[model samples]
Target: MGRVEPSLFSSTSDPGIDQANRPDPRAFWVVTFAFVLTVTSFGKYEISRLTPLFFYPVTIGTLYGVSARALLRKAFFALPFVLLVGLFNPLLDRQVLLEIGGYSLSGGWVSFFSITMRSMLAVTSAILLAMTTPFDRLCLGLEKMRVPRVLVTQLQFLHRYMFLLRGEALRMVRAHDLRAQGNKPRIALSTAGSMIGLLLLRALDRATRVHRAMLVRGFDGEVRVLHPLRFSWSRDGGFALGWILYFVLVRLVNLPEWLFGWVVGR
Candidate 1:
């Protein structure tokens, strides 16, 4: 079988290095879920309060050696949808909520900013999870958590063969280019349609052959892992508990405000 191409959703290319340091996938998922839930619990206009929640992703990504640039790049794709979600807030909410040196801050803008920040944080956490956790491992973790087998299998196959489909499409494009004699840089509408249909046919054929091969190899619907996942209570449990407590604390206390008050009070 061809190696799975490295992508944002796959773990680091070196399995040995990651396997030792990586937290249990199930624990990581729980921590991520808790963090996201805590983030959304903040009020709609409490943008400043959400500042402390940013530390989780930053710290985790740093420890995992996942660069901030890559995380931000992946998170950038979700910003457009985030913007659309809050696009009408500024217009609908014109009430002045605060003032700074003769300038009034409108409630709409505050809410809009809050929405944007919360969304970016949540999206970054999810992307970070995908970056650190291998897709197969993630599916396995979910299966262990009692997720439906069919759903997990579908996710597994989708992540597994997406690159193969892309490769096939690339080959078709290359063949088209070779026959075009370098005359057409862009494919015509009709040619593009034909290519799409042909790709679909090829993908179907490939799936059939793969299924037969799997059957010959004693294929079963269960996800089989080389090493069974062992969740260490002292390590993985501590990891999850520590993060969950931090999330709760950050949610309950506005650390930025408290720090600022202490500084000024001194």
Candidate 2:
């Protein structure tokens, strides 16, 4: 049978074996933490400097068998919010900072561009993290890295149970569709509120039963993984160290300028 597509919030869509060749989730977590820290550390107008940081997401995507196009497409959904946040930058900071090809560039526009680039990098990093690591493994990694147990447990439960909530919603919508009047199938605003209330009650009832089932199955508030994670020094350590070194180098060096000068024999 073909692979069954999962719900939006469901993360175990694919088998964990798919990530076999991938680095340990904890290693990915470390690098992601460092990557975000480095990307956001750049100044407001340092968009050019941030270009090299794109290498992290691109490289990680490639390594994890995710295409650059897919990563960018996923990251694109977050840009509108970022744009909204930076919308007033150009209007408020009109002081010209430089001229490029006779076109004056204001500090506001420069900062706006910088903000957008940073946001894209950050979002891309996060998307890559989610793409490469399964939700269960990610929570395990977080717990290993000293993240609070309560938070990790909550996240685990949220991811595991979101599919149940989605199924309940889908059933309700389907039932509504079957009962509604002919042709244009739509939920009336008047009925939507009641439907939502009904969904909430159904969700609570479902959650209670699921919790009882889990308790019967020996769920003692501890998340369990089918395949326990083991940190490999040669593999995981090398992967993290290599990326960390590259990030540090990129942060301290003007790579584009250096490449240009080298090409020109300067």
Candidate 3:
């Protein structure tokens, strides 16, 4: 699963649309599966062949109401690790595959490019799914899709508490800064290490308190959603079929090549 950098609680521009706006969360699931399958099929193609395929999701995501800026920013989350993974490819794969004038390019560079493009496409589409569907609702959707209760339950709790732990850590940092030298503020490396341990201790204490409170109120380790999961054959079924068909067509035909050919056939 890809991580998104945006705030989960931030509302989109259209307040009228939300996780429950559509009758079925499966609509999003269908779209996700189609996109993933399409990307996977591109594995057999090289850089030039797969380049345009990657951009298709960007267009789809934008049409689905995800802003271009958000897509790019979220896509960048996987970039550093992707860069690290491909860093040695150019060095190790030195077989010259292309020559332009005096400059020669190796297979390593081509493979690295392909890897980077795939990474960006995968991460961006995953982020788009998150942006379109609320996390809790997605978990419920997963549960509906027969995903294991334990996995969904853990994911729900982790998402719920990440913010709590972040807030606590920030408060600790603020207090430490206040007590330190104002003009030339700096913490000793040993002190910094101790603060990290202190942060974990504080997080644990907070978690225990929250758990006790939940138990006092009769929490049975189940997070409940207020709305019922609705499914309509007319809406959700057609929606699923439409997007899945589009993905299938794109997978079978080189859409970019076809479109280019169509444009030039005057």
Candidate 4:
């Protein structure tokens, strides 16, 4: 069976809104705050306390229409890298640190737990940001935040052509499927070579056509984006205040320990 396409919801039906609306600065700040919080949370060696931090981004992403399954899948992809790093924590430090339920665990185990939790938070926060923000807007936001012009231009170009390349690949796959008559041929060395050659030729032709089109439209090196980003005082202020309060409450106060301990103890 073919893979089911996800049901995507947008805030507006207008094409302009769907394709190129300016992202709210408030949302951007909130996402940024979550990212900073996630990173700071990892610097500590406490696993139990870090559990509460997950709820921030989880709630934000869920409310913002980011696919939870997609986020989890991305998180899982990064899991092996995280686990590999955590694995060394157990091997390098072998001191008994804690005892629970008649079993004594090493300090390495505690360190490993903290490392894993940190990795999860980092990965999840990144995935959440990517899911909520469109690529072009993200680049634009970075540019607004004073990133180098060269880097921003490079990112925009890369993102634009990556989509083009993926579309080309999809077309090639569909053409191959049509020609194969329901037989899925394993890509051997010879077939792979021929496919690569064909794809390169097609890509070159497409690039030529795109260049011609650009020339026809008065081609310039600089890409002009019409929708300029504007900062709203109220939105930005409210967003900043909310995150500041959250950070103070979560990190500065011992609320997690007090709340969780009371509930568990009760």
Worst 10 residues of 4 by lDDT: 1-10
Clashing pairs in 4: none
Question: Would you estimate the TM-scores of all the predictions?
Answer: 0.88, 0.88, 0.83, 0.75
The C-alpha local distance difference test score for the whole of candidate 1 amounts to 0.83
Write model 4 residue lDDT over 9-111, tens digit each, in one string: 2111223224233345435646565656645655435777677677766776666655677668768989999889888777888888888998988888898
Q: lDDT per residue, candidate 1, 1-266, as tens digits?
A: 11222534332243534565789989989999998999999999998889999899989988887788877877899999999999999999999999999999899999999999999999999888887877767777898898899999888777656655776798999888988855777788999999999998887788778778888888887656686778999989999999999998898888999999999999
Per-residue lDDT of candidate 2, residues 1-266 (tens digit): 11212212575746634667778999998898899899888898887788888888777766666767776777789989999989999999999998999999999999999999998888888887887677777888898889999999998778766777788999999999999998879999989999999988898899899899989999998867777788999999999999999999999999988888899995
Local distance difference test, candidate 3: 0.72
The candidate that wins on TM-score is 2
Local lDDT at 33 for model 1 = 93
Root-mean-square deviation of every model: 3.2, 2.7, 3.9, 4.6
lDDT: which is higher, 1 or 3? 1
- Cα distance off (Å), candidate 1, residue 11: 9.2
| lDDT minimum window of 10 residues, candidate 3 | 4-13
Ranking by TM-score: 2, 1, 3, 4
* 190: Cα error in model 2, Å: 3.2
Each prediction's number of clashing residue pairs: 0, 0, 0, 0
User: All candidates' lDDT scores?
Assistant: 0.83, 0.83, 0.72, 0.65
Q: Which residue pairs in candidate 3 collide? A: none
Cand. 4 Cα-lDDT = 0.65
